[model samples]
Target: MALDQLDGELEDQEESSEELYEQHSFKIDGGQEPLRIDKFLVARIEYATRNKVQKAIDAGRVLVNGKTTQSNYKIKPADEIIVYSHYEKRGERIEPQPLPLQIEYEDADLLIINKPAGLVVHPGSGNPDGTLVNGVAWYLQQQNPEISEETLPRFGLVHRIDKNTSGLMVMAKTDQAVTSLAKQFFNHTVYRRYIALVWGDPAEDEGTIIAHIGRHKRFRKLYDAYPEGEYGKDAITHYTVLERFGYVALIECRLETGRTHQIRVHMQHIGHPLFNDDFYGGDRIVKGTVYTKYKQFIENCFAICPRHALHAKSLGFLHPTSGQQMRFDSELPADMDQLIEKWRRYVKAKGDLIVESK
Candidate 1:
């Protein structure tokens, strides 16, 4: 029933974009007590806060019984409700700049790009220029000489990969493209796989991590994973080992639910953080011995990657217009390949080094 509701709301909205993709519907049970709609919605919604619900209400994105409702409207039993949330394009104009872009695929509606490490996906805070969007905007402006930079649409990305995670990304070039891609993401049908070099080999060649991922209560920037699903949104990460180097392993990760930092947090929960992931304490020598040589070897490996050893290797989805499925694959980035090579040489030179218990 929720899936059906998702489809209806998506089709009805014309202001859809990558940032504004969340839509869900719910019905109050027969035994439910009357409560303010904003509070009720926040409790039922995943990753939602009170402020967000109130903001949505103010924006008239929340409907009760097919009419826009205020934050204080009391919900009753069997009452139908729909909540829509997404970041509206801001009024502030984004200045376009010409920058180098690696275009993997381009058509009338979208562009697929092979993003590199250390490049931020969108502009915010300290990074306001040299972003992928600015480059794309410039390219679009170049193609349409009649269209001025000021008239270019604000943004086009349907999803995002982390700044340090090099990989392929698709961005919409038209309003219809954005809506179709958003629906696929909301329904969890968009296929994406990642390659990661982590601190240790898994006992099984392949496995899955089903856990709830939410922001840490104490650490503002970190996430704490709950296996019992008591808190946070549901997240599942399936991984398979591709290679092992005594202290580290190359693995493939496929995501079933795309929560923020899902792979990094899930791997850390399982004692195998991504190699060189500075945020989750993987930057240290997590699985290697204390020998000086071993420490130096790991340090060199860190230098090679310099960031979390993660790459988005593949993407698949149904075409927005043609309704045909498309999948794209990419070779490992040079930095990750170099890091893997270093590990291979180290493991070969020194036989399997057992990792002792903490």
Candidate 2:
């Protein structure tokens, strides 16, 4: 269907509200024919959801050439469009709460953090506060009152890690830094390494996994390797075994290409899935006579870390301004450390038993 038709459908569904509202104006330039309003909005606006765009269209909240049109409405070059939106005024401010943040390195360009496990990087649907972003904003403001809303570092975020994954992350302080760092990421020049504890030891000590990843057709939230070219992107991971328990192995993975959940998904593609990843959906426990000595420890560790056992261990990139190469590292969080220690003890105990039997 044509783009304007989609806009009409979107406009038909909007519900009117009595709350105070605001209006913003936009102009379309240098186009042959009218373009779909929704498509145009998505391109022009940052952080706008589909639902939000549709709602505005339906409410007759958007105008094309001074006339209300559907979300799919077409517009010509130089057409004037005004959008009525209900948004919190910009002058209102939110106070940042005091939260603990692990600062690894900091400079005028960016802040490097050893983000702890169990901490959300930013606020979202279920988490509105106590995020790494909030903490960073608070810390900056306290350090310099000059870092006001207008001057605040856009939090210059470059990348992300899962809430349960502990690791090194870089945040930009200046617009130039944000732009340069983003280019490095897009060019795949940023080097990232992660440490993961997975079930089972692979036959080979080191190997690479190359697969295309996309949303699972059956399950909406989880991602899986595409089976037959429906939806997926190229991903590459290289892993080397650091240590081995009776059943589990500690592996370090370097990313030649990074995709969402790349380490966990690629590890699962090999016979060894991460220790406790319910979303990938594995048997709750790995029970075998061969793993008897270490089974209890493994189960306990997995239970304690309900999320996947992956840590972003290191990050490397070129300084955006200085043109110097820099690298940062983060130690495994306490929980992961404890799990590794317990596994070591189990292996030692099992060895002692075997010697006694001999």
Writing each residue's lDDT as its tens digit, candidate 2 over 155-242 gives 5555667777888888877645655675567457888989888887667778888777766667656667753445676677888888
- The CA lDDT at 171 in model 1 is 80
Q: In candidate 1, which residue pairs clash?
A: 20-86
TM-score of each: 0.76, 0.69
Q: How does each model score on lDDT?
A: 0.76, 0.67
Regions of candidate 2 where Cα sits further than 4 Å from its true position: 1-95, 146-154, 227-230, 287-295, 303-306, 352-358
> What does candidate 2 score on TM?
0.69
Poorest lDDT segment (10 consecutive residues) of candidate 1? 2-11
Error of 1 at 66 (Å): 14
RMSD of 1: 8.7
Where model 1 places Cα greater than 4 Å from the true spot, the runs are 1-20, 24-85, 88-92, 145-154, 353-358
Candidate with best TM-score? 1
